[model samples]
Target: MRDIMGMMGKVKEMQAKMEKMQEEIAALEVEGKSGGGLVTVVMTGKGELKSVKIDPALFKDDDVEILEDLLVAAHKDAKDKVEAVAAEKTKAMTAGLPIPPGFKLPF
Candidate 1:
């Protein structure tokens, strides 16, 4: 009985922590650059694209394909960063729990 109560308490505590962690993740922002800094992407942890920046030099009429490629690369980089940060936060939040290896939290 005591263990059950304790476990419930922990569950509630974890729930509260998760709520706060989610808020923190939602507010997180990261930047990614590509093409030797010719393009950059800014994205939120929730994977929403906030903005993009491309160097004026990349605005060539003949190099539209290159610019498009750089934009894609930059977006991918930012997405990876966002995932990394989210994983890190999830790990920290679940520290000391009995979660199994490779078990992902539902963000």
Candidate 2:
């Protein structure tokens, strides 16, 4: 039964690591920009938008639609970056665990 006990210990250790990783990810902040750096957004690893910035030069009435589009693009960029960060962290945490390729986390 030593093997089972050792496995249990490892499982507990992995659980603690996963908890810490989740905390770190929740505290992560990332920025994404678009439209020649005219638009930018900051987001947390949880996909929550924290802030947005747009260059004042895009204030023209005709550029409203363009500005809107840039805002959307910037948000998408930020969300993608957040996902990448979370995925990288999860991958690192699960390294050599023999998890299925398509498995999801949060166990």
Q: TM-score: which candidate is best?
A: 1
Q: Whose lDDT is greatest here?
A: 1
Candidate 1: residue 38 Cα off by (Å): 0.5
TM-score of each: 0.94, 0.91
Q: What are the Cα lDDT values of the candidates?
A: 0.91, 0.89
Cα error, candidate 1, residue 37 (Å): 0.9
Candidate 1 has a TM-score of 0.94
TM-score of 2: 0.91
Q: What range of 10 consecutive residues in model 2 has the weakest lDDT sum? A: 56-65
Pairs with steric clashes in candidate 2: none
Candidate 2: where are CA atoms >4 Å away? none
lDDT of 2 by residue, 4-99 (tens): 999999999999999998889888899989998999999987878999998888886666888889999998988888788889989988999999
